[model samples]
Target: MNAQTLSVPAAIRARRTVRHYRPDPVPAELLDELLDLATQAPSAWNMQDRSIVVVSSETGRKALSEAAFGQPQPLEAPVVLVFVAETAAWEAANTDISAQATGSGAWNEQFTAMFESRAEFHSLRDRGLIRENAVKNAMIAATYVMLAATSLGLASAPMNGWDPELVKQAIGIADRDDLAITVMVTIGYTDAPPPHPGRRPRERTVHTELYAG
Candidate 1:
């Protein structure tokens, strides 16, 4: 079908996870608008810990491709966006700490009060409900970005099939372990419509109040 024949609804429904991408370049403004739209995603308690790093340069894309287990899509796509979450951002957003307060001791009590409900938060980095909440929020933000790309006549694929540590290093993240790379999304034009992954019917998946027993 011709471009004009494809309706907005059709485009929305047709967009899919594109693994292979053409070399065609995506306009800088479009990428900016999509990322800007993604920032609107709500975070846990509105902390907005989710941060995005957009890679548009050929050299940067190559580095990301290496980090992503040699996934050609990262290099081929006009844009590769890395979603990162600063674990400490939650605390930093709530209370501004002076330069003097910079250790496990200095902020231990602060975080203790913040994530007291979860047992995992006592020692683990991202194992507690509070950290889980951050992860969920970051995923939601990436979803907004994907859907926005679909709306803007673009195809996108969100992939987590890579080494997080390598990605952090390639992206030049200082504290690699503290900031987690939640997801990676590649966006660009497509030569062919992607194969559909059909969804389940609403009746089977949705419940009115409680689940059927």
Candidate 2:
């Protein structure tokens, strides 16, 4: 329940990317729970503007593999979750609240009127602070999902090596600009041993007083 009480070290050690799976399906309930756990991640102003597209079908996996530079692991894993950072949702919420307080029901319409287009909506993404928060929120949510999967005895890999626009288009989402792909996570059991070789020694990665002090 509390950060201090969490046994994260054990979870960190157990969590790994398993490329080989036994073709077993992840239970729907467990998948739902894992997604719920991911939302527990903190977001800017509690916006929580993140969405997930679960790709479980063979066709979906094939498309994802293509989007991910033809990586075969997406096809091997039972599930591939595409984490999306929804900037439009946050923009719409802020616009609605501002309009309600100012007694204007047609807020976005008014914005379109002034800009002579839908340019104002795109302005929301131009703001560096909002963009930064959007990315941070999405990444934190993905971390939660990975940790939850580990706790559930499932292996996962957080991926960012993909074409965002292509992946968004492949997923068939209408609002392409609004939702930006942040990461992908493959979930399943592993046949190979955990690849613990890549990790840095604890002493090298951690510090006590100060680095080079």
Candidate 3:
């Protein structure tokens, strides 16, 4: 990673969907730091159910590349992060979060009791809400990792082309039904600088109160 880091805004602008990467490896310490920053992303109810499996080994990257329909990014980048959303983890995390929140005076007994109903709120017959919650939390964390990489002068690519079942097998968690592979991000060094970008007019895309049709 380059020591000349960018400011937050600069990093936001610097991040690119890099497909080509150099073979230079990301240090273990730096990778750990990035992962730590990723977990700092906000979670619903502070339950913090987001997770990532670091796919660093060559064999793992090979599997991930195949899972991504033979995409070269996973194979080219030195590190690939597998973002997993555990739909069932939200209910399991409630107890720990509730207890901690109450202990910290952020929640009282009555408030904590109300929080338990969140399970019922998400437990529709179709389980759609549960999956939605999980994916939202996981994506936020993945975004953090992407920006953090750019801030450190590293390159990253957020990939959505992977087959979920194949990804699960790549991570050795195929038997688990509650987990969903929301996204994967490849992080490494890149020689190519990001190209200039074009954005829609703010008036057209950014509505004030309600959406503009």
Predictions in order: lDDT: 0.75, 0.74, 0.87
Model 2, 1-213: lDDT tens per residue? 122222467777777766667688888877887788887787754556787888999998888888889987788899999888886666453544344534655346564354334353356556655555677788998898888888776778887888877788768874576677888899877766466767667887788888851
Q: Model 1, residue 195: what's the lDDT?
A: 74
Please give the lDDT score for candidate 1.
0.75
User: Which regions in candidate 3 have their CA more than 4 angstroms from the true location?
Assistant: 1-4, 119-127
TM-score of each: 0.76, 0.75, 0.90
Clash count, one per candidate:
0, 0, 0
Which pairs clash (backbone N, Cα, C closer than 3 Å) in model 3?
none
Q: State candidate 1's TM-score.
A: 0.76
Per-residue alpha-carbon lDDT of model 1 for 5-60, expressed as tens digits? 33456656767999888888887777778778898887654567778898888988
Selected candidate, larger TM-score, 1 vs 2 = 1
The sequence of per-residue lDDT tens digits that candidate 3 reaches over residues 30-127 is: 88889989988988777677789999899999999999999999999999999998777755536878888999999888778767767554663156
Best by lDDT: 3
Question: Which regions of candidate 1 are displaced past 4 Å?
Answer: 1-12, 93-127
Error of 2 at 164 (Å): 1.3
